[model samples]
Target: MDGGGDPQVAGPVIAALMERAAGETRVAMSPETAKKLIGLGATVRVESGAGVTASIPDSEYEAAGAVVGDLASTVAGADWIFGVAAPDVALLSGAKPGAKVAAVFDPFRDRARTDAYAAAGYEALAMELMPRITRAQSMDVLSSQSNLAGYKAVLAAANTYGRAFPMMMTAAGTVQAARCFVMGVGVAGLQAIATARRLGAQVSATDVRSATKEQIKSLGAKPIFVEKVAGIEGEGSGGYATEMSDEYKAAQAELVSSHIAKQDIVITTALIPGRPAPRLISDAQIATMKPGSVIYDLAVAAGGNVEGSEPDVIVEKHGVKIIGFSNTPAHLAADASALFARNLFNFVSAFWDKEKGEIVLDEEIGTAIRLTQDGKVVHERLLG
Candidate 1:
C-alpha cells in the first residue's frame, strides 16, 4: 500500500480549503474523507477552520490524521486541491504546478474562472459535469446536493405557509391538509414530493418527461401530465429535461393553471445545465393562485423557473409568497458537507492506482469533467 519503500518519493498531497463563495457553507472535505484519503497513502491537509460552518472542528480533522494549517501552509506543495466551488486561482499559488482542483467550476456560466485556472496551469475537474453513468453515481455532486435541496425546499415552504401541512381532527373543527404541487420531477422534484407527502400534504407533481409520471405515482402522489402533447417525452442526455415544444408548453401551462389555483404550495425544481431555467409559472399564473399560497423556486439561482422569483428574497405577488435560496444545500450544511466530501473522495479512490499512490482517471470520466490541462481550456464543450 505504501508503494514499496521508495526513499525519495512521497505519496500525493491532498488539500482542502474553506469555501469563499457567498452563502456557501459546505466544506469540500470532512474528517471522514480525510481519514480515508490518508488510508490510501495520501497526505491530507485541511486549512484551519475549514469545516467550522459544517460543524466540524479542526481537532476532529487532526484526529482523523489530517494536518490542519493556515491557507498558505495547507496548499503548499499540494497535488490535489478540493473545494465546494473552484477557488480563485490566486488562492492556489502555493500548490504544485498543474495540480488537480476538483470542484463545481460552473464552466459554462463562468468562463473567466475556467480560463484563469487554465492560465495558471492547473487541472480543473468540474464535478458538476460528472457524466450521468451508472459507475459515476456515487461521485455525482449534483444529485447528492439536489436530493437535499428538494427536501429543504418543501420544509422551507411549509414553514412560510400560513396553514399547517397535515389535516387535524381537533375538538373544535377539522383542518384540511395543505395542497403541494411540484413542478419538474428531477432529483429535487422527486425529493420535494416525498417530503411534502411525509409532511401530510396532498401532493401532486408534473414534469416534462412522461416517464416521471410513474415515479410520482410510486411516491403516492398524483401525476399531472399533458397527454397527447408533443415534447412530453422531455428526457435529455445525462437524465436532464430538455426544452419542451411550444405546443406542449401551452398545454402544460393550461393544465397547471387550472390545478395551481386550488393548491396551497408549489415547488419548482426545473433546471437545464448551462441554460436558464425553463419558465414554468408566469406572473399571471401566480396571480391566479389562492391568496395565501406559497411557491418555492429551487432554480432561482439559475434564473428561476417561476417568474419574479428572487434568490434569498421572499416576494409577495397577488397575496402569494415566492421564495428561493441562492444555495439551498448550504442551508443543510452539516449533511451537505459530509455527502459532498464523500463524493470527491469516491471519485478519487475509484481511480486510485495503489502502486503509484495516485489517482489515474480513465478516458470516459476524465473527458467529461476535465476542464483544463497543460495551460489551455481542454474540455470539448468549452473549446468552441
Candidate 2:
C-alpha cells in the first residue's frame, strides 16, 4: 500500500476495492483507500494520516477495522497490492518478489517501466489492456471511463455552440434543433449520439463498421455510411476499429466533408488503442463547417481525430471552435471512479483466494491479465 493519495476523492475504484475485500479475505489497504475497505470487512493499515487530503480522518479507518502503522512494514508482508496508477520504482523495491500487483500500468505507453516490473519478478496486471470481450465487460475500465467521456463531450459541445440543442416553440420565434454529427460508432461515440438525441438534437453518426449503422439508426439517429471498399471490413479483434488504407481514408474523408459542413456540432470519438487516432477531419474540412460550429475531439490524447485539436485547450480557426479535452472522464470523477472501481473488483475477484492467502490466475480470465508474463510481454496483438 503506497498511500500515495486518497482514493475516495480520486474515484469509486476505492469503494469497489473495499467491497470486494468483504468476502472472507484479510486484505490490507493504504490509509487513503482503507477507510472504505475497513467498512467492507478487511483490516486496514494507515500511515499516520494518509486520508487527510480526501478529508478522511485517520481515526475513521481505525473505527472501520484498521491499524495505523509504518509504510515499510505494511508492504513487507502484503501478498497483493492494488492502485489506480502504477507504483514508483522506489515503492516497487519494497514489495517482495512475485507479489501480485494490479493497477492501470499504461503498459502501452510505459513499456520500459513495465519491462522493469517484469524483470523485478512482479506479476503486473495492466487494467487498461483488458480485452474488449463479452466475458471481460465487467473488467473493462477503458469502456467504463470512456462512457462518461462520451456523455460529457455532448454537454461540452452544447455549451460551446451558440444555438440551443432542442427545437423550441416560443412567443418570439420557433428555434430549430441543432444538428450534431458524431464520428466513430464505438462505445463513446454511441453514447454521444444517445446523449445528443436525448437533448432533442437531430443526431447523425458515421463509422467504418457497417454493423454499427443499425445501432445508430435504432437510437433514432441517422447513420452516415459511405460506400464500402473492396477487401476492407473495418473490423478488429476485441471490438476496435482497424487501420484503414490510404485510399479508403481518402474516400471516407471526401464523403464526410459534405456531411460535416451541415452539422452545427461535431463530436469525434475515433480511436485505435495503442495507436495514433485516425485523422478524420482535416483543416479544410474544419474550414467548411458553419462558422459557429463546435468540434469536440474525444481522441485528442492520441493526436486527435480532428484537425487543430490541442489537448485541454479550445482553439478557434476561421470561426470554427475545436475543443480538445485530454481527460474528459475526470470531469465526472465520482461516477467514473465508481465504474472503474467495479471494473477492478470484477477483475481481481477471479484471482482472490481467501483461505490460502494467495492469488491463483485462472487461465481463461487471466488470459487477458497476463499481458506480460514469464519475463515477456505477451498480448496477442502487442507481441511480435
TM-score of every candidate: 0.97, 0.82
Q: Residues 279-354, candidate 2: write the lDDT tens digits.
A: 9999999999889999999999888988779988889987999996777876665566556656765665555556
Sliding window of 10 residues with minimal summed lDDT for model 1 = 1-10
lDDT of each: 0.93, 0.70
What's the lDDT for candidate 1? 0.93
Candidate 1 lDDT over residue span 265-372, tens digit each: 999999999898899999999999999999999999999989999999999999999999999999999999999999999999999999877889999999999999
Q: Which regions in candidate 2 have their CA more than 4 angstroms from the true location?
A: 1-76, 228-235, 354-357, 371-383
State which candidate has the highest lDDT.
1
Candidate 2 lDDT (Cα, 0 to 1): 0.70
Worst 10 residues of 2 by lDDT: 15-24
Number of backbone collisions per candidate: 0, 2
Instruction: Estimate the Cα RMSD of every predicted model relative to the unseen true structure.
Output: 2.2, 6.8
